[model samples]
Target: MSKKILISVVGPTAIGKTKLAIELANHFNAEIISADSRQFFKEMQIGTAAPNSQELASAPHHFIHHKSIHENYSVGDFEKEAIALLSHLFAKNDYVVMVGGSGLYSDVITKGLDKFPNVSPDIRKNLNEILKKEGIGPLQRQLKVLDEKSSNSIDLANPHRLIRALEVSIGSGKPYSSFLNKDKEKRPFKTITIGLQADRSIIYDRINKRVEIMIDKGMVEEAKKLYPHRILNALQTVGYKELFRYLDGEWDLEFAISEIKKNTRRFAKRQLTWYRKNQDIIWFDFNMSKADVFQKIDKEIITVQNE
Candidate 1:
């Protein structure tokens, strides 16, 4: 039998990846698996730019709002579940489309996660204490010194990610990034990555506009609903975090909105940094017509399957 194909739609946030994935899925009669970490939570639909009702109806989708914010979900858990879902999907369709801006989550499907040495629980406890007392600055600086690559690519604003990287680097006496992609498990399906990108200025402009749209669509209200649960890892993302600060009275709404746009731009840049290293993604300008992208993807699918 011919190898099945997994077509990944990846790029920075607000870049039309979901639209493209739906079109691809429709054309191929395939299903979509969302690798976006934020979209997993049911409460974060507006903030995460999750597919709307029409989009969900256009394609069969998995892993979108399938978990609650209160659940303790990890990348390892996602890997197990997604791999099993792929097995079921491949048995029915020749192509399966996975779409998301969360590069780490996407990588777990394409390249299996690397295992790191266990660190003492006290290390995490100390890091949490530092975060609570001094804020995320000290931990960020520590990761910057210990694993510069991870510091550059991962979400620096997330205290959980910072602590995880720092603990691994501190305990193993090796840069946390050094352990990544070291044991990529083979998958039965052939994988093809499609990246949508544009100039930095254009990307930033899109992010700004999207943030404004989200605010108009009641993202502030959504954030308010989730604010009581701000400590949840799911709420630590860009849009809600900024709104949480606004709700905290630390900054005015205007300033909070601006920070949301600014932080989202930074997140997009970090996403590009992570994906550029893969070298497998076939990139297209975000403005390219869907027809042209579909033509190119068809060629790539044929080429990948023949390899």
Candidate 2:
């Protein structure tokens, strides 16, 4: 049997990942499965910068705006669905493209997730209540006391992540990080990881430009429509969260826009930090032309297949 290949285009937000992935998919005549966690919500198109209708029409893409903001979709859910979709796609095409900036989601599909012990619902509910009443600071402190490793690694500001670690630590009497990388499920295919990056200033500039374009393209309107659901986990992401403050009386529109740009740059830095740990990835300048990138990928695929 021929070896199946999965090409993953990974990078910071607004680094032209979607365009590269589409071009690669078209070149390889393969389907695309998006790994962007924010782009999963159907109601968050403009804010999420999901593929427009023309881009969607250019290639067959899956998991783009496939779920609603009201739906609770987890990383585990994406891993299962994406792997299953890859299985089906592999039966027809030898190559498929996976693209996004969500490192956790990509890691799940490529390396498999660690098995975690189930914590009681009571613990989770209580944590949620504490978050609502007190706030994330309490939970962050609790996680630091219980599982300092996870507290340092996870987004401490994200209540959902902090509470998740706390619940597992308090309920199972074990640190959540202890479960990671214990047992990785082996997949049949080989993944070619291509990382796109630019200088810090260039990346920040791109992010700022993208934010301005998003605003002009009606991101505010989209956020307004979803403001009622701002409390949902799906809406807690970078772009929407900053805009939600504007919708609320918490910040002025100008400040909110500036905040979005600043937060997005921070998010991109975190993404680079995560992706840089893997030494196997072949990095490319984000400004590279499509032909040059495609040629490099083709050469890499050939090299991998030859080995």
Candidate 3:
């Protein structure tokens, strides 16, 4: 049997993953599957930086703006849907490119998800109560003590993720991290991971510039349209949350924009930390030319095929 390759393009936000993925997909004659959680929402175009018309035209992309903000979408859901799509795509082509900065979503498509014992719904309910009453800090601190690795990798600001982790820890009497990298379901195809990276200073600058561009691209107006749906999990992201604060009179526009830039930089740092844990990734500088990147990916694919 022939082997299909899923070429995953992963990196921090604003690190040019989209550009690189398009080039790779076009060169390899493959379609692109997006694993970016924020980019999945149809209402979060500007803020999430969903591909522009031109970029989308460059190559066929899937899973972008495929869900509504009001819908309940989870990593598990993405995994199943993406795998289904890949099955169809792989039947027609041996190579498919997956791109996104979302580590867990990407892992579901590439490394497979970890299994966990069932936790009572009451546990999740109680955790939500705690989050509502006390905010995310207590849950974060608790997770840090119980599962430091999860705390490091998770988006601490996300109430849904924090509550899920806490419920598992409380119900199973074991840290969440203990459940990871175990019982990973094997996939039929092989994955070749390519990661983009840069110095901290360069990454931070790129994030800042991207935030400015988002704001200029009417991020505030976009957030306003979704402000009524602010309580949705999709709106809990960095750019929208900051602008929602501005709408709430918590901060002025300038201050809110600054907060967005700061939080985005922090998010990018966490993304880098997550990707660094995977030793299989072949890293490339963010500024590497497209031709050079294609050369590297070509070499990596050849190595995988020969093995």
Candidate 4:
């Protein structure tokens, strides 16, 4: 084997990405590295939709359930760890597959993470605290002043991203864009991106139904256990964040359920927006038959091997 191929399967939530990725991994005789930010934590299985053991048993996987919810993990950390894992896996197997909806995490591996100067922990903590107390509006203001270009392009509703941009701005006294737009670093492998796409209505319906299934699978109780840590950045996810409102008495049960569906649909939109920017992707519609998708993927792998 040439050891130069890494196939990435990416798409919006509940678009059957997991099932497809596993099939590709099997077809290529490779393992999987997850790019999901939430699924990194061990205690977050139900809410994060982390793969069950049976699914994992179908293929050797990495970076799933690898950390505690209490531990802090960043895109930089993911880049370092995932790359190391890839290097090790590629040493044994010629190719590997990475799959998830987290665009930043995938970018960290493919486009290369930008290097930034260190900032004191105090600045990050204080910015996070103020963000919690004041909501997204305050951080939005700071990020606009600090990096208007990137700020305008990002999801304004995501306070964690907004505040992180602010922290980088204040800490380095430079626009976050300065660091973000740095040149991409080279990697050894040839990347073959396979994007899963579907009709807008179908994707939205899947997202809504997936949220309901998550709740029925004990996501509410899981959120309750992590409510004390809701202020943590990792807990800023869609499903758990909405349920936290119910736990805090801000919304009735039915209202919270509705919010989860609405917010998840919004998340799927954001995900599509994010992935659309990557033109390197070879998109396959979600309606394709499983065997057909795998055949396409396997042919791509063999094509890559020939190169």
Candidate 5:
């Protein structure tokens, strides 16, 4: 049996993943499967940077604007859906690309996700109550004592993950880390990972500029439309969270903007930390010529094809 090639473009925020992925998809006769967790929601186009109309038309993309903030979606579902899509795409094309900065989403597509025993609904309900009453700080404290390893990898700002880990730790009588295994699962296709990076100042400047562009594109209205649903997990993202504060009059507009910049810089650092820990990725400077990046991609493809 022949195997199709999977090319994954990943890096910190504002590192040009979308444009590069689209161009690479066109070159490799591939389609793009977006691995960004936030970009999945149709309501979050501006903040999540869902592919513009031109990029969507450039090469077929999947998992972009496929869900609503009101609906529930998780990494396990993403892994299943992405594998199914990869199988279908492989039937038609020789290569497929999955692109995003979301580490968990990327892991789902490239590495088969480990399934954990389900926690009781009642436990989840109580956890929610605790989160509502005590706030995320208490939950973070519990996680530190119960499953510090999981806390290190998962999103600390997310109430859903924190509560879920607590419930699992109590119900299953095992550390949440035990549920996350390092054992790799075999897949039908081979995935080659690419990382994009830039000088620290340049990347930070790009992030600041991107946030400004989002505002110019009516990000305020976008967040306003979803403000009523602010409690949802999807709205907890950096841009939305900061804007939510502004809508609540917790801080003035200027302060909210400053918080967005600070939070985004932190998010970018976290993303780089995740990617840097993985030895499989080949890093490219973001300032490199388009041709140079393509040449590196071509070399990887040739290596995979020969293997």
Candidate 6:
């Protein structure tokens, strides 16, 4: 029996990962499993840069818009469901492609989820109270003090992520980052990770353009509809959060759009910071031609298969 391969296309947001993944899936005669946590929610289509109808029809895709914003979906849940789906996929195809910008979720599939000490519910309760009384600012400052590394890498804008890190840091009497990348679960398939990257200026420019396209595609209207559910964890995203502020009358639409661009740039930087730590990823310029990229990935696949 031959071993299966999981080719992961990963990089910063708006870096053409979805296009590359579709092409690879078609070349390899495989299906795609989305590791982008934000894309899993059905309500966040326009803002999350989810594959459109044409793109979804281009290849067999899994895990995109499979959950609702109202549902509680964790990385652990994703790991279980994705692995099961992979087993079913591998039975029919020798290769499968996984793509996303969510580093933590992707890591769960490739390198097992990290184990953390049990945190007391009271600690999270206290943190939520603080967030309610003040805002995410104080909690952000506290995490910066407790786990500066995590502060730089994780999405600092997400309150659920912030609270999770704080509770673990406080409960375990150690930095939250101290618990990461400590566990490895051997998988049944060989893995190849391809990363797309570009100059910081180019990446930021792409993000700015993407945000504009989203706004033009009625992201504000989508946010307005979901604004009533603003407190949901799924709603705690870059694009929607900014528009939520606009809807709250805290900022005008222009200012909100600018903040969305600025925050998205920061999110892209953090994503690169996270993926850079993984030495196994093969990096490529985002503008590389499809044929050239395909050649390099094919060579890698052959090398891994022979090993």
Which rank order by TM-score, best down to worst? 2, 3, 5, 1, 6, 4
Which candidate leads in TM-score? 2
TM agreement with the true structure for every prediction: 0.95, 0.97, 0.96, 0.94, 0.96, 0.95
Tens digits of per-residue lDDT, candidate 6, 54-82, equal 99999999999999999999998999999
Greater lDDT among 3 and 5 belongs to 3
| Tens-place lDDT digits, model 1, residues 251-293 | 9999999999999998998898889898888999998898998
Q: lDDT per prediction?
A: 0.91, 0.89, 0.90, 0.85, 0.87, 0.93
* Candidate 2 structure quality by residue, lDDT tens digits, 1-307: 5689999999999999999999999999999999999899899899888999999999999999999988888888998899999999999999999999999888889999878898899999998888889977888888888998888788776667777788889999999988888878799899999999999999999999999999999999998988888888888788888888888889999999999999899988889988987888889998888888888888888887887
Q: Local error of candidate 1 at 125, Å?
A: 2.6
**Maximum-lDDT candidate:** 6
Task: Report residue 112 deviation for candidate 2 (angstroms).
Answer: 0.5
Off by over 4 Å in 4: 1-3, 298-307
Residue-level lDDT for 41 in candidate 4: 89
- The candidates, ranked best first by lDDT, are 6, 1, 3, 2, 5, 4
Please state every model's RMSD to the true fold in angstroms. Answer: 1.5, 1.2, 1.4, 1.8, 1.5, 1.5
Backbone clash tally (model 4): 0
Instruction: Write down the TM-score for model 4.
Output: 0.94
Give the 10-residue window scoring lowest on summed lDDT in candidate 6: 149-158
Report the Cα lDDT for residue 102, model 4.
88
Q: Candidate 4 or 5, higher TM-score?
A: 5
- Predict model 1's lDDT versus the native: 0.91
The lDDT of model 4 is 0.85
**CA error at residue 171 for candidate 6, angstroms:** 2.3
Candidate 3, residues 231-277, lDDT tens digits: the string is 78788889999999999999999999999999999898889888888
Pick out the ten consecutive residues of candidate 4 with the lowest summed lDDT: 293-302
